[model samples]
Target: MDVCHYDVQVKTAIKEQKAEAIVLTDDGMNLTAFWTRLLCGCGTDGRFEPVYVMENIIPLFDKSFNYEIVERESWFYGEYLQAFYTPEANKIVIRDDVYERALAGVALDVITIAHEVVHCIQSIVMRFLNAMQCVEFKTAICSNDSNEMQQHELQTDRITSLVLSPDSLTEGKTDNEILQQYFINPLIQFVCGLIKTAGKNLLEALNDTNCYNEVKEVERCAV
Candidate 1:
C-alpha cells in the first residue's frame, strides 16, 4: 500500500456480527439490520457511507446493491478492487482476500478493509440521488463502461491509501500504483471474475435526496 493523506470523516467502525449467513436476497432484512450497525455507524435511516474491497469472491449484503455477499475459497487472488453496491437499498461490499492475505495481520491491511467500506458511502450517495429523482432508476444494476466503474474503484483505493500511509501518491510509490501494476495491470482476469460473481441485483433507482444540482449531474453521468 502507498502512503497518502486523508481526513477522518467516519469514526465508528463495524463490529463483526454473529449471524451464520444471511440469504443473498431481500428477505434477509434482519441480517441487513445487523449489518447496518456493523457497517456504517447508522442504519437504513439515511446514514450514508463508503466501502471498498479487493478479493475474487466474497458475499456482501448491501441494501444498496440489492444482494448478499460472502467470501469464496480461493487460494490466490491478485491486486485489484472488487465492490458491489445498491442504490435504493443502500449497501456496499468488498472482497479483500488478496489484500488481507498479503498484509496478513499487518496494520496496513486495515486500509484494505477501509477501502471496501468506502464503497458503502458511494452507493448511499448515488441512491440518494435516485430517490430525489435527480437520476433515473433502473431494475438491473448497471455495468461498467470500460473505466467508468474503475473510477470509483480507484477512488476507494485512494481513500484507503490516505488512511493507511498518510503520504501522497506523488511520494515514492503508492498503494494504488503497486496494487494496480502488480495486482490489476497484468490481470484483467480478476476484474472479470468480480463482474461475474460480484453478486448484485441493482434493480433500483434513487429513493430521495436534497442534492438537486448533484442529482442532475448524477443523471447525466449515469446515462
Candidate 2:
C-alpha cells in the first residue's frame, strides 16, 4: 500500500480504539494499574495472554545466546538487561530499572512497554499465518540470529508508531517519511523492504475479515 493508504489505515485503527492519551503522574499504583491493563490479556478479553516476567534486577541471557546484558554507570545496552520478548517463555520481561522509569513518568519507558505489546500481537499473527502454511513467515519467527531478530524489532517499531503516533502522519506523510522523521535507524530501509515483499499491510492482515469477530471480542474487552 502507498503512504496515503497506510496513513489512513493507521489513523482509522487508532480512531476505532478511542484511546486516551496516557498522562504521567506521581502515583505509582495508578501507573502500575494502567500499564497492567495495557500489557496484560485482561484488556483483550482473554484473546491474548502474555506472561509478565519481572525481576528485582536485570537478568543475564543464557551464555549460548548471542545477546548479553551490559550495564555502565551512565547507561546499559544488551538484550537481556533491557526489556525483551522471549517467545519460549511467551513473556515480555521488563527489567527493574525500566519499570522504575515508567513509574517515574518517563514517557519512552512506557512506550517501550507498548512496543513489546505489539510483539505479542505479532506473535499471535505469526502463529495464525504459520498454521495457514506460510513457510517463510514461520522461518522468520523461528530464526534466532541477529538479522532476523532485528527485522522483528524494526517491524514492531513501525507498528508501534502507527499505534502511538497516528496524528503525526496527518500531513500527507508516507510511512517511510514518518519513520525517517521520528525513528531514523539503519534498519529502516531493510524493514520497509521486508514489509513490501509481504504484500499486505500489517493492520489489514491482522484485521482480516475472517478474524473480525475475534478481533472485535478483544476490542470489546479493551475498551
Best by lDDT: 2
What residue runs in model 1 are displaced by over 4 Å at the alpha carbon?
1-39, 42-73, 76-105, 129-145, 159-223
lDDT: worst 10-residue window of model 1? 6-15
Q: How displaced is residue 209 in candidate 1, in Å?
A: 30
Tens-place lDDT digits, model 2, residues 1-223: 5655665674454234321122112221122222333343233122222123122111222222221222333232233335655554545656667666756667777677667655544444334323433223323333333455555556556555544543433357676864554335324544665677586776677678659888889999999
True-vs-predicted CA distance for residue 86, candidate 1, Å: 9.8
Per residue, candidate 1 scores C-alpha lDDT tens digits across 160-215 of 44434333322466668645533354245445545554433222222233466688
Instruction: For model 2, state the Cα shift of residue 172 in Å.
Output: 6.5
Which pairs, if any, clash in model 2? Answer: none
Give me the runs in candidate 2 sitting further than 4 Å from their true place.
1-80, 125-143, 168-223
The CA lDDT of each predicted structure is 0.37, 0.44
